[model samples]
Target: MGKVYIVGAGPGDPDLITVKGLKCIEKADVILYDRLVNKELLSYAKSEADLIYCGKLPNYHTMKQETINTFLIKYAKKGKVVTRLKGGDPFVFGRGGEEAEALAKQSIPFEIIPGISAGIAAPAYAGIPVTHRDASASFAIVTGHRKEDAEEEVKWENLAKGVDTLAVYMGVSNLPYICEQLIKYGKEKSTPAAIIERGTTSMQRTVTGTLGTIVEVAKKEQIQNPSMIVIGEVVRFREKIHWFEKQAENAYPVSGVL
Candidate 1:
Protein backbone atom coordinates (compact mmCIF):
# COMPACT_ATOMS: atom_id res chain seq x y z
CA MET A 1 0.00 0.00 0.00
CA GLY A 2 1.16 3.54 -0.68
CA LYS A 3 1.78 5.99 2.18
CA VAL A 4 1.46 9.73 2.58
CA TYR A 5 3.65 12.01 4.67
CA ILE A 6 2.73 15.47 5.87
CA VAL A 7 6.10 17.14 6.37
CA GLY A 8 7.13 20.48 7.76
CA ALA A 9 9.79 22.29 5.76
CA GLY A 10 10.73 24.52 8.69
CA PRO A 11 10.39 28.31 8.44
CA GLY A 12 12.44 28.79 5.25
CA ASP A 13 16.03 27.60 5.50
CA PRO A 14 16.68 24.18 3.97
CA ASP A 15 18.98 22.96 6.77
CA LEU A 16 16.33 23.74 9.38
CA ILE A 17 14.18 20.87 8.05
CA THR A 18 14.06 17.92 10.43
CA VAL A 19 16.18 14.94 9.34
CA LYS A 20 13.08 12.72 9.27
CA GLY A 21 11.20 15.15 7.03
CA LEU A 22 14.15 15.35 4.67
CA LYS A 23 14.32 11.57 4.47
CA CYS A 24 10.61 11.39 3.61
CA ILE A 25 10.99 13.97 0.85
CA GLU A 26 13.96 12.08 -0.54
CA LYS A 27 11.73 9.03 -0.97
CA ALA A 28 8.52 10.67 -2.12
CA ASP A 29 7.21 9.88 -5.59
CA VAL A 30 4.84 12.88 -5.50
CA ILE A 31 5.62 16.12 -3.67
CA LEU A 32 2.79 18.58 -2.99
CA TYR A 33 4.13 21.81 -1.49
CA ASP A 34 2.88 25.10 -0.06
CA ARG A 35 3.54 28.70 -1.06
CA LEU A 36 6.23 29.70 1.42
CA VAL A 37 8.21 26.47 1.12
CA ASN A 38 11.80 27.09 0.06
CA LYS A 39 12.98 25.56 -3.21
CA GLU A 40 16.29 24.46 -1.67
CA LEU A 41 14.43 22.01 0.52
CA LEU A 42 12.72 20.53 -2.58
CA SER A 43 16.12 19.18 -3.66
CA TYR A 44 15.60 16.37 -1.15
CA ALA A 45 12.77 14.96 -3.27
CA LYS A 46 13.55 12.22 -5.76
CA SER A 47 14.61 13.51 -9.17
CA GLU A 48 11.58 11.97 -10.84
CA ALA A 49 9.13 13.09 -8.15
CA ASP A 50 5.94 14.74 -9.33
CA LEU A 51 6.34 18.25 -7.90
CA ILE A 52 3.01 20.03 -7.53
CA TYR A 53 2.42 23.55 -6.26
CA CYS A 54 -0.54 23.38 -3.91
CA GLY A 55 -0.92 26.84 -2.45
CA LYS A 56 -2.54 30.24 -3.10
CA LEU A 57 0.32 32.67 -3.39
CA PRO A 58 0.05 36.44 -3.98
CA ASN A 59 -2.39 35.86 -6.83
CA TYR A 60 -1.78 32.34 -8.03
CA HIS A 61 -3.28 29.19 -6.63
CA THR A 62 -1.98 26.38 -8.76
CA MET A 63 -4.13 24.03 -6.76
CA LYS A 64 -6.76 24.87 -4.17
CA GLN A 65 -6.78 23.01 -0.85
CA GLU A 66 -9.68 20.67 -1.66
CA THR A 67 -7.95 19.84 -4.92
CA ILE A 68 -4.79 19.13 -2.96
CA ASN A 69 -6.69 16.65 -0.82
CA THR A 70 -8.09 15.04 -3.93
CA PHE A 71 -4.63 15.09 -5.48
CA LEU A 72 -3.12 13.33 -2.46
CA ILE A 73 -5.81 10.62 -2.44
CA LYS A 74 -5.48 10.19 -6.20
CA TYR A 75 -1.72 9.74 -6.16
CA ALA A 76 -1.77 7.66 -2.97
CA LYS A 77 -4.30 5.27 -4.51
CA LYS A 78 -1.86 4.76 -7.33
CA GLY A 79 0.46 3.17 -4.75
CA LYS A 80 2.95 6.04 -4.87
CA VAL A 81 4.54 7.58 -1.80
CA VAL A 82 3.28 11.16 -1.48
CA THR A 83 4.62 14.06 0.51
CA ARG A 84 2.66 17.16 1.49
CA LEU A 85 5.54 19.52 2.13
CA LYS A 86 4.40 22.53 4.12
CA GLY A 87 6.02 25.58 5.66
CA GLY A 88 6.40 25.28 9.43
CA ASP A 89 4.86 22.50 11.55
CA PRO A 90 1.96 20.98 9.63
CA PHE A 91 -0.28 21.10 12.72
CA VAL A 92 0.43 24.74 13.46
CA PHE A 93 -1.86 26.80 11.21
CA GLY A 94 -0.77 24.56 8.35
CA ARG A 95 -4.31 23.20 7.69
CA GLY A 96 -2.79 19.75 7.97
CA GLY A 97 -5.75 18.61 10.02
CA GLU A 98 -8.17 19.06 7.14
CA GLU A 99 -5.93 17.17 4.74
CA ALA A 100 -5.42 14.40 7.27
CA GLU A 101 -9.16 14.12 7.87
CA ALA A 102 -9.76 13.79 4.14
CA LEU A 103 -7.05 11.15 3.88
CA ALA A 104 -8.60 9.16 6.72
CA LYS A 105 -11.90 8.91 4.89
CA GLN A 106 -10.05 7.49 1.91
CA SER A 107 -8.23 5.06 4.24
CA ILE A 108 -4.84 6.34 3.20
CA PRO A 109 -1.97 5.38 5.48
CA PHE A 110 0.03 8.43 6.47
CA GLU A 111 2.64 9.84 8.84
CA ILE A 112 3.24 13.35 10.10
CA ILE A 113 6.75 14.73 10.55
CA PRO A 114 6.82 17.87 12.66
CA GLY A 115 9.19 20.74 12.02
CA ILE A 116 9.99 24.02 13.82
CA SER A 117 6.97 26.31 13.58
CA ALA A 118 7.40 29.82 12.21
CA GLY A 119 5.53 31.17 15.26
CA ILE A 120 8.53 30.27 17.43
CA ALA A 121 11.35 30.01 14.92
CA ALA A 122 10.68 33.32 13.17
CA PRO A 123 10.74 35.27 16.43
CA ALA A 124 13.86 33.42 17.50
CA TYR A 125 15.53 34.27 14.20
CA ALA A 126 14.50 37.89 14.81
CA GLY A 127 15.91 37.82 18.36
CA ILE A 128 12.54 37.76 20.11
CA PRO A 129 11.25 35.15 22.54
CA VAL A 130 7.60 34.14 22.70
CA THR A 131 7.95 33.78 26.43
CA HIS A 132 10.33 35.44 28.89
CA ARG A 133 10.85 35.24 32.63
CA ASP A 134 9.82 38.72 33.72
CA ALA A 135 8.17 39.89 30.55
CA SER A 136 5.84 37.13 29.41
CA ALA A 137 4.77 33.65 30.53
CA SER A 138 2.30 32.62 27.86
CA PHE A 139 1.73 33.25 24.15
CA ALA A 140 -0.99 32.61 21.58
CA ILE A 141 -0.30 31.77 17.94
CA VAL A 142 -3.06 33.24 15.78
CA THR A 143 -3.53 33.15 12.03
CA GLY A 144 -4.13 36.51 10.43
CA HIS A 145 -6.48 34.83 8.02
CA ARG A 146 -9.18 33.27 10.19
CA LYS A 147 -12.32 31.52 9.10
CA GLU A 148 -14.42 34.23 10.69
CA ASP A 149 -12.88 37.67 10.99
CA ALA A 150 -15.62 39.53 12.88
CA GLU A 151 -16.41 36.63 15.18
CA GLU A 152 -12.72 36.22 15.88
CA GLU A 153 -12.33 39.93 16.54
CA VAL A 154 -13.28 39.67 20.19
CA LYS A 155 -11.37 36.47 20.62
CA TRP A 156 -8.25 37.97 19.08
CA GLU A 157 -8.69 40.99 21.35
CA ASN A 158 -9.01 38.76 24.37
CA LEU A 159 -5.88 36.95 23.35
CA ALA A 160 -4.10 40.22 22.73
CA LYS A 161 -4.99 41.46 26.20
CA GLY A 162 -4.75 38.16 28.07
CA VAL A 163 -1.80 36.36 26.58
CA ASP A 164 1.61 37.55 27.63
CA THR A 165 2.68 37.49 24.03
CA LEU A 166 0.83 37.44 20.69
CA ALA A 167 2.42 35.82 17.64
CA VAL A 168 0.33 36.28 14.52
CA TYR A 169 1.15 34.13 11.53
CA MET A 170 0.51 35.47 8.00
CA GLY A 171 -0.63 38.67 9.74
CA VAL A 172 1.26 41.33 7.83
CA SER A 173 -1.84 42.53 5.98
CA ASN A 174 -3.99 42.78 9.08
CA LEU A 175 -1.45 44.50 11.29
CA PRO A 176 -3.11 47.91 11.24
CA TYR A 177 -6.58 46.64 11.99
CA ILE A 178 -5.38 44.12 14.60
CA CYS A 179 -3.34 46.71 16.44
CA GLU A 180 -6.26 49.08 16.38
CA GLN A 181 -8.54 46.43 17.84
CA LEU A 182 -6.02 45.58 20.54
CA ILE A 183 -5.55 49.20 21.47
CA LYS A 184 -9.32 49.66 21.62
CA TYR A 185 -9.62 46.58 23.81
CA GLY A 186 -7.24 48.05 26.42
CA LYS A 187 -3.85 46.74 25.29
CA GLU A 188 -1.20 49.29 26.00
CA LYS A 189 0.02 51.36 23.09
CA SER A 190 3.60 51.10 24.29
CA THR A 191 3.61 47.33 24.16
CA PRO A 192 6.74 46.14 22.42
CA ALA A 193 6.19 44.63 18.98
CA ALA A 194 8.09 43.29 16.01
CA ILE A 195 7.51 42.16 12.41
CA ILE A 196 9.89 39.62 10.91
CA GLU A 197 9.97 39.24 7.12
CA ARG A 198 11.06 35.98 5.47
CA GLY A 199 12.45 34.73 8.75
CA THR A 200 14.95 31.91 9.30
CA THR A 201 16.27 32.48 5.78
CA SER A 202 19.01 34.68 4.33
CA MET A 203 16.28 37.19 3.40
CA GLN A 204 15.16 37.67 6.98
CA ARG A 205 14.58 41.23 8.15
CA THR A 206 13.09 42.36 11.46
CA VAL A 207 11.50 45.67 12.38
CA THR A 208 10.91 46.46 16.04
CA GLY A 209 8.90 49.12 17.86
CA THR A 210 5.87 49.67 20.09
CA LEU A 211 2.45 48.33 19.18
CA GLY A 212 1.35 51.89 18.45
CA THR A 213 3.99 52.44 15.77
CA ILE A 214 5.05 49.09 14.36
CA VAL A 215 2.42 49.24 11.63
CA GLU A 216 3.79 52.50 10.28
CA VAL A 217 7.34 51.37 10.92
CA ALA A 218 6.87 48.13 9.02
CA LYS A 219 5.27 49.97 6.09
CA LYS A 220 8.14 52.44 6.02
CA GLU A 221 10.60 49.57 6.10
CA GLN A 222 8.60 47.77 3.38
CA ILE A 223 8.46 44.51 5.34
CA GLN A 224 6.39 41.84 3.54
CA ASN A 225 4.62 38.63 4.44
CA PRO A 226 5.78 35.02 4.97
CA SER A 227 6.55 36.58 8.34
CA MET A 228 5.62 36.50 12.03
CA ILE A 229 4.28 39.24 14.31
CA VAL A 230 5.30 39.27 17.97
CA ILE A 231 3.74 41.69 20.44
CA GLY A 232 4.44 41.87 24.19
CA GLU A 233 6.92 43.07 26.76
CA VAL A 234 9.09 40.10 25.81
CA VAL A 235 9.84 41.87 22.55
CA ARG A 236 12.21 44.04 24.58
CA PHE A 237 14.51 41.08 25.14
CA ARG A 238 15.82 41.38 21.59
CA GLU A 239 18.26 44.00 22.87
CA LYS A 240 19.99 41.60 25.23
CA ILE A 241 19.29 37.87 25.15
CA HIS A 242 19.61 36.94 21.47
CA TRP A 243 21.46 33.86 20.12
CA PHE A 244 20.15 32.78 16.71
CA GLU A 245 22.34 35.10 14.65
CA LYS A 246 23.60 32.29 12.40
CA GLN A 247 27.15 32.07 13.66
CA ALA A 248 28.14 28.98 11.73
CA GLU A 249 26.60 25.53 11.76
CA ASN A 250 23.47 25.25 13.91
CA ALA A 251 20.92 27.58 15.45
CA TYR A 252 21.50 27.46 19.20
CA PRO A 253 18.51 27.83 21.50
CA VAL A 254 18.48 31.20 23.20
CA SER A 255 18.84 31.48 26.97
CA GLY A 256 16.35 32.75 29.59
CA VAL A 257 13.13 30.94 28.83
CA LEU A 258 12.50 30.90 32.56
Candidate 2:
Protein backbone atom coordinates (compact mmCIF):
# COMPACT_ATOMS: atom_id res chain seq x y z
CA MET A 1 0.00 0.00 0.00
CA GLY A 2 1.09 3.58 -0.62
CA LYS A 3 2.32 5.97 2.04
CA VAL A 4 0.36 9.19 2.63
CA TYR A 5 1.90 12.50 3.60
CA ILE A 6 -0.21 15.27 5.11
CA VAL A 7 1.65 18.47 4.36
CA GLY A 8 1.05 22.11 5.15
CA ALA A 9 1.45 24.70 2.36
CA GLY A 10 1.52 27.58 4.87
CA PRO A 11 -0.79 30.57 4.35
CA GLY A 12 -0.76 32.06 0.84
CA ASP A 13 2.97 32.60 0.41
CA PRO A 14 4.76 30.02 -1.70
CA ASP A 15 8.00 30.82 0.06
CA LEU A 16 6.33 30.06 3.39
CA ILE A 17 6.19 26.37 2.44
CA THR A 18 8.61 24.22 4.40
CA VAL A 19 11.54 22.43 2.76
CA LYS A 20 10.15 19.07 3.85
CA GLY A 21 6.67 19.65 2.39
CA LEU A 22 8.17 21.00 -0.81
CA LYS A 23 10.42 17.96 -1.19
CA CYS A 24 7.49 15.62 -0.65
CA ILE A 25 5.37 17.29 -3.33
CA GLU A 26 8.26 17.27 -5.76
CA LYS A 27 8.39 13.50 -5.47
CA ALA A 28 4.70 12.77 -4.93
CA ASP A 29 2.85 10.41 -7.24
CA VAL A 30 -0.44 12.13 -6.29
CA ILE A 31 -1.21 15.37 -4.45
CA LEU A 32 -4.50 16.19 -2.73
CA TYR A 33 -4.28 19.87 -1.93
CA ASP A 34 -6.50 22.28 -0.06
CA ARG A 35 -8.36 25.13 -1.77
CA LEU A 36 -6.43 27.89 -0.06
CA VAL A 37 -3.01 26.53 -1.13
CA ASN A 38 -1.40 28.93 -3.57
CA LYS A 39 -1.71 27.56 -7.11
CA GLU A 40 1.88 28.54 -7.83
CA LEU A 41 3.04 26.12 -5.14
CA LEU A 42 1.75 23.21 -7.23
CA SER A 43 4.47 23.80 -9.84
CA TYR A 44 6.82 21.80 -7.62
CA ALA A 45 4.78 18.63 -8.05
CA LYS A 46 6.10 15.92 -10.33
CA SER A 47 5.00 16.52 -13.91
CA GLU A 48 3.40 13.07 -14.12
CA ALA A 49 1.68 13.21 -10.70
CA ASP A 50 -2.06 13.65 -10.36
CA LEU A 51 -3.45 16.76 -8.61
CA ILE A 52 -6.80 16.56 -6.88
CA TYR A 53 -8.67 19.52 -5.44
CA CYS A 54 -10.09 18.85 -1.98
CA GLY A 55 -10.55 22.45 -1.06
CA LYS A 56 -13.28 23.70 1.24
CA LEU A 57 -14.77 27.15 1.36
CA PRO A 58 -16.10 28.86 4.49
CA ASN A 59 -19.61 27.69 5.41
CA TYR A 60 -19.30 25.19 2.56
CA HIS A 61 -17.51 21.93 1.93
CA THR A 62 -16.48 20.78 -1.53
CA MET A 63 -16.17 17.12 -0.57
CA LYS A 64 -17.95 15.11 2.10
CA GLN A 65 -15.68 14.01 4.97
CA GLU A 66 -16.50 10.33 4.54
CA THR A 67 -15.89 10.52 0.83
CA ILE A 68 -12.48 12.09 1.33
CA ASN A 69 -11.55 9.53 3.96
CA THR A 70 -12.59 6.66 1.76
CA PHE A 71 -10.79 8.09 -1.21
CA LEU A 72 -7.51 8.39 0.71
CA ILE A 73 -7.70 4.80 1.87
CA LYS A 74 -8.66 3.53 -1.56
CA TYR A 75 -5.77 5.38 -3.20
CA ALA A 76 -3.24 4.10 -0.66
CA LYS A 77 -4.18 0.52 -1.43
CA LYS A 78 -2.53 1.01 -4.85
CA GLY A 79 0.98 1.43 -3.41
CA LYS A 80 1.47 4.97 -4.76
CA VAL A 81 2.99 7.85 -2.77
CA VAL A 82 0.04 10.07 -1.94
CA THR A 83 0.39 13.56 -0.55
CA ARG A 84 -2.52 15.36 1.14
CA LEU A 85 -1.48 18.98 1.13
CA LYS A 86 -3.33 21.43 3.36
CA GLY A 87 -3.16 25.18 3.81
CA GLY A 88 -1.56 26.59 6.96
CA ASP A 89 -0.80 24.02 9.65
CA PRO A 90 -2.46 20.67 8.97
CA PHE A 91 -3.47 20.10 12.62
CA VAL A 92 -4.58 23.63 13.48
CA PHE A 93 -8.28 23.79 12.71
CA GLY A 94 -7.50 21.96 9.44
CA ARG A 95 -9.19 18.60 10.25
CA GLY A 96 -5.85 16.89 9.76
CA GLY A 97 -6.63 14.98 12.96
CA GLU A 98 -9.56 13.25 11.29
CA GLU A 99 -7.43 12.45 8.26
CA ALA A 100 -4.76 10.93 10.49
CA GLU A 101 -7.34 8.81 12.23
CA ALA A 102 -8.59 7.55 8.88
CA LEU A 103 -5.08 6.53 7.91
CA ALA A 104 -4.65 4.66 11.19
CA LYS A 105 -7.89 2.72 10.67
CA GLN A 106 -6.33 1.16 7.60
CA SER A 107 -2.82 0.86 9.10
CA ILE A 108 -1.43 3.00 6.26
CA PRO A 109 1.97 4.57 6.69
CA PHE A 110 1.64 8.36 6.83
CA GLU A 111 3.68 11.37 7.87
CA ILE A 112 2.51 14.80 9.02
CA ILE A 113 4.40 17.87 7.85
CA PRO A 114 3.75 20.98 9.93
CA GLY A 115 3.45 24.53 8.59
CA ILE A 116 2.70 27.97 10.01
CA SER A 117 -0.89 28.36 11.09
CA ALA A 118 -2.90 31.27 9.70
CA GLY A 119 -4.08 32.15 13.22
CA ILE A 120 -0.58 33.09 14.34
CA ALA A 121 0.57 34.36 10.93
CA ALA A 122 -2.48 36.60 10.43
CA PRO A 123 -2.10 38.43 13.74
CA ALA A 124 1.63 38.83 13.21
CA TYR A 125 1.04 40.45 9.81
CA ALA A 126 -1.32 42.90 11.52
CA GLY A 127 1.30 43.64 14.19
CA ILE A 128 -0.60 41.96 16.96
CA PRO A 129 0.92 39.27 19.14
CA VAL A 130 -1.36 36.55 20.41
CA THR A 131 0.32 36.81 23.79
CA HIS A 132 1.61 39.88 25.57
CA ARG A 133 2.65 40.92 29.08
CA ASP A 134 -0.09 43.48 29.69
CA ALA A 135 -2.30 42.56 26.74
CA SER A 136 -2.75 38.82 27.24
CA ALA A 137 -1.14 35.76 28.71
CA SER A 138 -3.33 33.17 27.02
CA PHE A 139 -5.33 32.74 23.83
CA ALA A 140 -7.83 30.36 22.31
CA ILE A 141 -8.46 29.47 18.67
CA VAL A 142 -12.00 28.35 17.82
CA THR A 143 -14.43 28.15 14.95
CA GLY A 144 -17.41 30.50 14.88
CA HIS A 145 -19.73 27.75 13.80
CA ARG A 146 -20.44 24.41 15.44
CA LYS A 147 -23.30 22.03 14.57
CA GLU A 148 -23.98 20.27 17.87
CA ASP A 149 -24.80 23.28 20.03
CA ALA A 150 -26.41 26.66 19.95
CA GLU A 151 -24.00 29.45 19.13
CA GLU A 152 -24.12 30.35 22.80
CA GLU A 153 -23.19 26.87 23.83
CA VAL A 154 -19.75 27.27 22.31
CA LYS A 155 -18.86 29.10 25.57
CA TRP A 156 -18.25 32.62 24.32
CA GLU A 157 -19.14 33.83 27.80
CA ASN A 158 -16.36 31.90 29.49
CA LEU A 159 -13.95 32.63 26.68
CA ALA A 160 -14.92 36.26 26.86
CA LYS A 161 -13.84 36.22 30.50
CA GLY A 162 -10.94 33.77 30.29
CA VAL A 163 -8.92 34.48 27.20
CA ASP A 164 -7.02 37.65 26.62
CA THR A 165 -6.59 36.87 22.96
CA LEU A 166 -9.37 35.35 20.88
CA ALA A 167 -8.76 34.24 17.31
CA VAL A 168 -11.90 33.04 15.62
CA TYR A 169 -11.60 30.98 12.45
CA MET A 170 -14.46 30.76 9.94
CA GLY A 171 -15.65 33.95 11.64
CA VAL A 172 -16.14 36.61 8.98
CA SER A 173 -19.76 35.79 8.23
CA ASN A 174 -20.61 35.46 11.90
CA LEU A 175 -18.60 38.45 13.10
CA PRO A 176 -21.47 40.67 14.06
CA TYR A 177 -23.25 37.95 16.00
CA ILE A 178 -20.10 36.81 17.73
CA CYS A 179 -19.06 40.32 18.64
CA GLU A 180 -22.46 41.18 20.03
CA GLN A 181 -22.48 38.05 22.15
CA LEU A 182 -19.02 38.77 23.50
CA ILE A 183 -19.95 42.30 24.52
CA LYS A 184 -23.21 41.11 25.98
CA TYR A 185 -21.46 38.37 27.84
CA GLY A 186 -18.98 40.72 29.57
CA LYS A 187 -16.08 41.26 27.16
CA GLU A 188 -15.21 44.91 26.74
CA LYS A 189 -16.91 46.40 23.70
CA SER A 190 -14.14 48.96 23.53
CA THR A 191 -11.55 46.20 23.25
CA PRO A 192 -9.41 46.59 20.18
CA ALA A 193 -10.09 44.26 17.24
CA ALA A 194 -8.53 43.71 13.84
CA ILE A 195 -9.04 41.61 10.75
CA ILE A 196 -6.13 40.30 8.75
CA GLU A 197 -7.24 39.31 5.27
CA ARG A 198 -5.13 36.99 3.07
CA GLY A 199 -2.31 37.08 5.56
CA THR A 200 1.30 36.45 4.49
CA THR A 201 0.34 37.39 0.91
CA SER A 202 1.31 40.57 -0.89
CA MET A 203 -2.36 41.47 -1.16
CA GLN A 204 -2.85 41.08 2.58
CA ARG A 205 -5.00 43.76 4.23
CA THR A 206 -4.96 44.86 7.86
CA VAL A 207 -8.05 46.56 9.18
CA THR A 208 -8.24 47.71 12.80
CA GLY A 209 -11.06 49.06 14.96
CA THR A 210 -12.70 48.55 18.34
CA LEU A 211 -14.98 45.63 19.05
CA GLY A 212 -17.82 48.11 19.50
CA THR A 213 -17.25 49.34 15.95
CA ILE A 214 -15.48 46.52 14.04
CA VAL A 215 -18.67 45.13 12.61
CA GLU A 216 -19.53 48.51 11.16
CA VAL A 217 -15.97 48.97 9.90
CA ALA A 218 -16.10 45.52 8.29
CA LYS A 219 -19.39 46.35 6.60
CA LYS A 220 -18.05 49.66 5.36
CA GLU A 221 -14.89 48.01 4.04
CA GLN A 222 -16.61 44.91 2.60
CA ILE A 223 -14.19 42.44 4.23
CA GLN A 224 -15.47 38.94 3.46
CA ASN A 225 -14.92 35.33 4.46
CA PRO A 226 -11.63 33.47 4.94
CA SER A 227 -10.65 36.32 7.22
CA MET A 228 -9.53 36.31 10.87
CA ILE A 229 -10.98 38.42 13.72
CA VAL A 230 -8.55 39.21 16.54
CA ILE A 231 -9.77 40.63 19.85
CA GLY A 232 -7.40 41.88 22.56
CA GLU A 233 -5.46 44.86 23.82
CA VAL A 234 -2.52 43.66 21.72
CA VAL A 235 -4.34 44.85 18.63
CA ARG A 236 -3.74 48.37 19.89
CA PHE A 237 -0.02 47.79 19.40
CA ARG A 238 -0.48 47.44 15.63
CA GLU A 239 0.20 51.09 14.88
CA LYS A 240 3.50 51.11 16.78
CA ILE A 241 4.89 47.68 15.88
CA HIS A 242 3.90 47.30 12.22
CA TRP A 243 6.84 45.33 10.76
CA PHE A 244 4.98 44.05 7.75
CA GLU A 245 5.27 47.69 6.70
CA LYS A 246 8.64 46.80 5.23
CA GLN A 247 7.07 44.05 3.18
CA ALA A 248 4.17 46.30 2.29
CA GLU A 249 6.54 48.88 0.87
CA ASN A 250 7.87 46.28 -1.53
CA ALA A 251 4.46 44.70 -2.20
CA TYR A 252 2.90 45.90 -5.42
CA PRO A 253 -0.84 46.41 -5.55
CA VAL A 254 -1.68 43.11 -7.18
CA SER A 255 -4.95 43.11 -9.08
CA GLY A 256 -7.44 40.52 -7.79
CA VAL A 257 -8.74 39.36 -4.43
CA LEU A 258 -6.31 39.03 -1.44
TM-score per candidate, in order?
0.90, 0.93
The digit string of per-residue lDDT tens for model 2 on 1-258 reads: 899999998988799899999998998898888888999989999899999998898768898778888878888899889989999999988889999999998999999999988888888877889999887899998787745567564598888888899998888888888898889888888999999888878777878898899999999999976788899888988988878856677665566775
Please give the distance, in angstroms, between residue 98's alpha carbon in candidate 2 and its true position after superposition. 1.1
RMSD of 2: 3.2
Model 1 over residues 1-258: C-alpha lDDT tens digits?
Answer: 689999999989888999999999999999999988898888877889999987767446678788999999999999999999999999998889999999999899999999899999989877788987888889998877645557777786688668999989878888898788788888889999988888888777778999899999999998887778998998898878655555423555566666
Per-prediction backbone clash count:
0, 0
Best by TM-score: 2
